[model samples]
Target chain A: MATKRIVVDPVTRIEGHLRVEAVVENGIITDAFSSGTMVRGLEIILKGRDPRDAWAFTQRACGVCTTVHALASVRTVEDAVGISVPKNAELIRNIMEAALYVQDHVVHFYHLHALDWVDVVSALSADPKETSRIAQSISHWPKSSVGYFKDVATRLKTFVESGQLGIFANGYWGHKAMKLPPEINLLAVAHYLEALEWQKEIVKIHAIFGGKNPHPNYLVGGVPCSINLNEVNAINSERLNHVSKLITDAMQFVNQVYIPDLMAIAPYYKDWGAIGGGMENFLCYGDFPTHGYNQTDSFKFPRGIILGQNLNEVVEVDARDPQQIKEYIKHSWYKYGAGDEAGLHPWEGETEFNFTGPKPPFDQLDVQNKYSWIKTPRWKDKAMEVGPLSRMLVAYAAGVTEVQDIVNDTLARLNVPVGALFSTLGRTAARGLETKLIVGWLKGFFDDLVTNVKAGDTTTFTKEKWEPSSWPQSCEGVGMTEAPRGALAHFIKINSGKIENYQLVVPTTWNASPRDPSGQKSAYETALIGTPIADKDMPLEILRTIHSFDPCLACSVHLYDPDGKHIHDIKVV
Target chain B: MLLLNPEGYMQNTKINTTLILGIGNTLLADEGVGVHVANYLNQKKLPDFVEVVDGGTGSFVLLGIMQNADRVILIDATIDGEKPGTIKRLTPKFSKDYPKTLTAHDIGLKDLLDAFYLLDTVPKVILYAISIAPLAEGLSLELSSEVESAIPEIVDQILKEIE
Candidate 1:
């Protein structure tokens, strides 16, 4: 077979444009590069705007995880302005975020990633009864099993009939990589529809609180909407119960349906475990810190820092420290001065239109023209891994008993020993498991809010009083939040009260990121190095791995309408 | 004024769902015009499943309702080469020749509705189009007077559609 590179530009259903380029040698992928083609300057565009607007604008950066961006943007501004949100506000935000988290994870698993593994065409061969049995074996819920599959068929039919392949258009149903019996495929297909409904329910929580999903209205001081007792009770009882059931159902599905499905499918594609698995250097800024303990302190959810390949002896991340962070744009197309000089806060950043052709694989020294609008973010002089896998690994290593036990059990079950549990599959599992933990955390948060409200905590939002003079001349702080993908950090600097500099080190920036100087590869890049590729064009393995990372380009930078194409110009051009 | 608020900001107002189409590019230019109008209708608490739409481009996307709707009021752009603020209400009869422009995104409203008719999705949807000025530039709409002026009539027609 003649060797050639295949570029799947603008991978569909993802938030933004991305090109997956790879070198093929005799039908094998010798090298691959994931490039983000869109350059969004939202970070810079956000400067000097009423910081409150960040809530609205930042979330627009990524549609999939818009809620996370909104929450984080609020947090970033709150941290910058120093405002302590009310308990109700915190709980509301927590619930909304958790809802989005579950929704996004479910959507990722069934809709996005599952298509790679679950063969859709095979479902035609499935016995609807056996499929129901397969679904039942996973978990028994009150829903009519027969009706569920029937609804699945109807919805699929409606979708096809709608002339909108809105979700499942590009599925490689008959691909060689797809493995799973018809019965299991049908079960998963049914679950996929269920997940969609669940996603709508979860998003409603946002609509109730934030007014809408996908760019829900959040405020710097607090959320714009309030929850009365009736609303709260309704959510706590009926809605929350349903959500809880869904989570539990999902866990059962993971253990029974997905795990078995993975196992059943793994044998056919054993080669995937080896490919797209990058350096295990994970970095988690941590989440759900108690009242007094800073993020560094261990809590129900712990912060994570993995210095190197050895996942043990987790390090602590200090947001106040500037020495540990530097964003290397050398390997990227950004025009930065020589070695170690590329790192700068976002406001003082440079925005130049320079398109250098794609750099060859393993060429870490070149800076002239690089692919991808994504920047290479480094923590403590290293490209650290961020996401559920990173968070879980940190939690497990830091002795979070529940996570540790789950990790151990899952690893033992896989028979690959307790170690490599931090690989591709591990990452996906971590995201799902993290949702379970977050839900519990949020329920408790709601309970605390009720208590606080009963105790007369009327301060849902506090106005930050800042004497213009009192504002620091220049200050830098790393704002870290748990985006759906993983840990997101924004190291911002304000000079004379305007945003003098800003740098967003996104979770994907670490995980799906490319290689950097010193020849250190990104977590995703390294992960892909060892994988064997059968067909370069049909880079299913690479897509699966990248999807595992759940890359969102909008959250990182600013995207502007560069050329306003009036209709006349559009035609002429 | 069409006062399109796809974001649904006006809940106390009166809105009938006889005709609703959301038009806008959640991704591109002042295309969100239809979404704004639909959202506005929604906020005003229009009839359930009011014909609200993001409309995007491709006014023809509304073709399915042409015969079904006794009177269609389509809210869109007015490219009369007039001042930027000019908005106009055009009741192009049910005989087709409706304007064809969708937002820069995929599947124009015309093609979408045409497909619906071709596929028999909604063979009897009437068409109501409001024309403002700008159709390109970016996501945010540049509302013109004619666009704004047509809102009340559009709302009235929508109520008529529902009635």
Candidate 2:
């Protein structure tokens, strides 16, 4: 029996291009390799520029992760300059980030990850009435009428019958791996559409706060929008009310549609609870700080590290500690002035591209050599998984009452133990649970903002240390935040007011990075092992796990055009 | 995954608009042409109906903005191998009509359109895909002379369409 090697290049329905190769003997995967095929020389663009303007550049790295990068970037400069944002600004930033989590997680579940589970073709065979019944049964979300479901099914059917599947074209539909009943598929599809429309409304909070959506404005001292209830130019009462309404709507959508859908879908994929539990170590740079950015104890998510699957105790994480987080290019397409064998802390990190050796063929990856454009990052020389699961587990471990309550309730409902929280199912469930929790936090933050505003703290920006003339000659700081995907950090070094060095260790770099010097595979690769591949040609199972990480590789492959050709499968090429 | 709806902005303006969205990544050379054209038209004293927006990569955030308009005219770069600066106008009836697989980002344009359909507010979608060469340079705002030259012609074409 020979081991069959399979590869899914440019995994669809993700933020960026990712190539995964796996060796499957019999039906189960034995070994896996993850490669991020795109290289974003964002740091190169940031060099020799004003440290204050870094967020605007880094924010362009991903269309989906627009605000997270901008937030991280602005915080980096602020941390370097030692500026404390005003209370209003802090509250607004937290509200914006919380809003992003709610929106990002919902989109990931329905639009991105839903297709991996709910088969669109199977959805056509669904009974709309049954779908409506299930929808009504799951949660009291409005618009679950029979007519609504019928209309959705009819539209889906029309689109399918037109012989043009479009976005739904390449789905591994009707695959044995798709376990949901047709009615449930239809239900998921309806919400998918609703989520799309609903998702668009959540970013209005960004527009009102930061003045734009995709690339919002961020300042070193504080947020961009000034708080003024009377003035038209500033964030007045009208704009604030609009934000308040959006948060309320987000809370409703999360509670009614998202959580209910997760509960309804989990029973069908319980076996997934055992597989895709790759690493026991989890890391989270806790976010949504109330006191100050430096106050980890005040963070809603709680700053900590869980080592070796230990949930009872959480190890403290310090981003500035050179010994804590170090990046290695052992199997990545990068080089170091210090050494390749040893990892370099991001401040000492080099962005020199060294593709000097003989190149592997375009399609085939020589995993033995430098195979990925992503650098391998490890916490204390150990590969730790990040994202919703890590944050939830950390919060749960730290005994955040809401997180603990939700996790326990969910676990009890699903009848799964704590160990299940590490698997693919656990990872997927964690995203939904945290979204519910984050929406509450958003509302809380929104109320806090309004209350503070009422208390006459209308300040949103600060001119304190606004000029670099008051700065030390050289300083460095690691601005860490837990993005929707995972722990995100931007390391910055400022010398003479110019950006002496800038490096972004994004969430994907931790989860999607290739094996390190010690040959320890990162989250994606390790998770894929032992998973059963139902079909060689269609690797929907692989997508289920990888999409769980919400990979944002930052694309660079718009070199050609489809020319009206329908891309049907995960092209091995 | 979310909204940045300038509903308040729309209310403040209080004018029915034929939204013209120029979509692309401005950081990439030709990929940012749509935004460049949009920024160009935005400065011009166009008719009240013409509302130009820089729809960066055309994802869900722009959906709320797009939905606010009565009709939408999307201008973007298309690499259909026709020529470096060939301009092609399309009234995309289906997601299949959009040239996606090899273009800037996956066809979030088409998927976004399909989502619009489910909402039952499918805006009159008109796409002007300006053909450009495969992007080679990195971290550039300068469009190639070929693509750059087509901007005025494309702008004229859009203006004519609006009229």
Q: Could you say which candidate leads in TM-score?
A: 2
Name the lDDT value of residue A176 in candidate 2: 97
Range of the 10 consecutive residues with the lowest summed lDDT in candidate 1 chain A: A564-573
Q: How does each model score on lDDT?
A: 0.55, 0.82
How large a fraction of the reference contact set does each model reproduce? 0.00, 0.40
- Total backbone collisions, model 1: 86
lDDT of 2 at B147: 91
Residues A202-287 of candidate 2 have per-residue lDDT tens digits of: 87778778777667788888888878889877888888888887888888999999999999999999999998997889999999
User: For residues B1-163, what per-residue lDDT tens digits would candidate 2 score against the true structure?
Assistant: 0112355453423236788888877667887888889988888888866777777764877777777777888988877777877888888876666776324354366667766766667777888898877666345657889999999999899989988
Where is model 2 more than 4 Å wrong at Cα? A356-363, A555-573, B1-15, B101-103
Give the TM-score of chain A, superposed on the true chain A, for all candidates in the order listed.
Answer: 0.84, 0.97
Interface Cα RMSD, each model = 10.1, 3.2
Candidate 2 clashes between residue pairs 3 or more apart in a chain or in different chains: A199-B2, A200-B2, A200-B3, A203-B3, A203-B4, A204-B3, A204-B4
Q: Which candidate number would show the highest DockQ if scored against the true structure?
A: 2
Q: What DockQ do the predictions score, one after another?
A: 0.10, 0.43
